[model samples]
Target: MADYDNSRYTYAQVLAGTGYYMKDDKLRYSAGVKTMQTKLNTAGYDSGTPDGKFGGGTDTAVKSFQRAKSLTVDGKAGKATLTELDKTASGGGNASAEAKNLKKKFGSIISSFASKNSIGEDVLGGFILTESSGSGFVDGALKIRFENHIFLKAVPSASTTFKVEDKVHYYKKNGKWYKTHTGKQTSEYEAFNLAKNISENYAYYSISMGLPQIMGFNHKVTGYDTPKAMFTGFSKSEDKQMEGFCTFIVNYSSGSLLKACQSRDFTKMGQIYNGDGSTYGPKLKANAADYAKA
Candidate 1:
């Protein structure tokens, strides 16, 4: 397996730059390799979890994927093959510019969140987009991110706009592009839920000249009777507070979530947000389940 710790910095920092996200969803493009997949499968090559992630399993699968398709089986992603891969990714469906818009918006949202929340922009951005969508949600992107969790087979939501009524945080922990994970835990559900609450309700709006939605954030006070005494424009609305919390949620979900998955710590932040990881298994390792993803 190719072990490159460089998946950090280089991954997230790319988010700051526009046009970094894929125009099509990652799974959408990978599905395009069906022809290649069938060929490999016929030749006794294990395509390994056809969820659509181009990972070790996928790479191993690619040798067969490429060989079946009559291409060089070097196993590195390239343009000509990827272009064809994308064409078939949507399963013969067309990827309009609107989808690409979503990818860019998604990236921009994460990048902006890093700047606003003082989080590591590079790390956050890297988590923003993955190999799942052609480019995290860029124009023509076929991949869709439900919350912050990675999924190569992620499909575009019916409504591109974030709806208040949407369940929002129910993440799919299995059946992903790769075979890296297996199941979801209560904590994961909570993290995804809190993250959605923060993203859709708070961070999307609520601004106050850099302070955004903090009352005494710019002040050095020790409980001056009331919050108003320290700062005048503090919003008491829970929605406003949610925005503040959402900034951190994005930061956590985008970075910590990925790390947990890499190091098998998926349940860390979730426990911190849900209850206590010490009580429950610190990490809910992915097993043999439809939800399992790499």
Candidate 2:
């Protein structure tokens, strides 16, 4: 795996530093807004003078930039908008050779699935880039950290199902499952143990696993006969994770989402993939464009 720390900065930092989404009204002037105006002007979006003030002209320019980049047309310079701007201002680099190597490793699988589903390779590539940053693991692990509240919500009464001797929790360590007193265990280990225990007692459908974050409950829709099967498959390799993702997409929306991606209709794609009230569509579209360029 690549050792490069390619993770971007936080959204709040981008907004504060870049004047993203700082619109002019009766409010005070902001330096960030002026910086954004200057950057937009440099990029040929034409935000007028760098007055450190936002108005109709700035809004129009922001919207234009968003449209050109296939971002959400909310006319606000949110995290996605600012990130794109930063990339453009810096003359963004293509995907590293390491990234290319990873892509090549999974190329055949992606291609096969794309062909079977009649989806474009670029679309699938973009999806992977956005969803997993082109990696199935993070920090040398399988990206299987536990989410505490989600586990608690999924399995309410642990005593009945887990059958713990006392106030203890189960977890995984070095490929072996172990149990520890409730407060003594880390959340991450507890999440794994809880998921495993739940799958054994109740059903796997309640757990969410792998790159696509597909839930265990949706095993039927995703073509898995059991939750353990889904979890085990995902744990096998990145290729299997991709397989699970493709399966879910193909079964859930019947290729409509893929079609939306091909057409560059991020609004519809986001609604379908992430459900309503999500702003991820534009970001996904932008990331896909970047991956295609690379």
Candidate 3:
């Protein structure tokens, strides 16, 4: 069983019932809550949608778990309750199985890309592993993340053009109240498709698509004619996703990513690809090493 830690939010924040709750008037979203919800579901406690929001269902589930485990009967997920929850949910099969499954399905494709590009298979494999665990398709649909900020950047007038509603946030800064559009919606493809009706190109450009999770705006670097083309291709086949990934690394930033992969420099790779060398670099390196062993 893997040890789940709250690197993003604190235990105190969770217990105070303010950090991860995203229901009704609350708009906070937490990856920590998502992890807990998944584990709770695995341990036979239903936490409803598992949408990274600690709502009423999650509260009920937590209280039920605490009652059963003889922990404090509060709905809050304190350190002890969380630890026990992890232990209970640890029975859900091998955690590394997903990575292994990725290799099993696309080992040949990874090797082909490595050989064609003169890069290490483990490096490429590790990159994919870090991105999607093995499969680019979730329930037969290409894995996608709709970036609301990117959408707004691409189509600044989408709110008026598409008749989309906005979630306005007004905050005091420098003793003046300013309003900003946080997003149209949170991680919902419906909002993305809605925007696509008015401007298909910008809609496609606003999402990170498929196994590699490359943003649609990078279609040129990935050798696609357009963001829509890349999205269509990636949605159809992981083979095309691998092709796009290989192409992206080779061409991104004038081949710097390729150079990094060639030297097995995950720090540089992470810096170039994810803009974070200190943390994502080590993670990619570890994933590559683990893939090699597996």
Q: Which candidate should be chosen as best, given lDDT against the real structure?
A: 3
Give per-model TM-scores: 0.21, 0.59, 0.58
User: Model 1: residues >4 Å from true position, as ranges?
Assistant: 1-59, 62-84, 87-99, 103-108, 116-255, 258-294
What TM-score should be assigned to candidate 2? 0.59
Please write out the lDDT profile of model 3 over residues 185-227, one tens digit for every residue: 2334555666687688988998888777899999999999999
Better model by lDDT, 2 or 3?
A: 3
Q: Which residue pairs collide in model 2, if any?
A: 19-32, 205-216, 205-217
TM-score of 3: 0.58
Best by TM-score: 2
Count backbone overlaps in model 2.
3
> What's the distance in Å from true for residue 173, model 1?
32
lDDT of 2 at 113: 80
Candidate 3 local Cα displacement, residue 262, angstroms: 0.6
**Residue 154 local lDDT, model 1:** 28
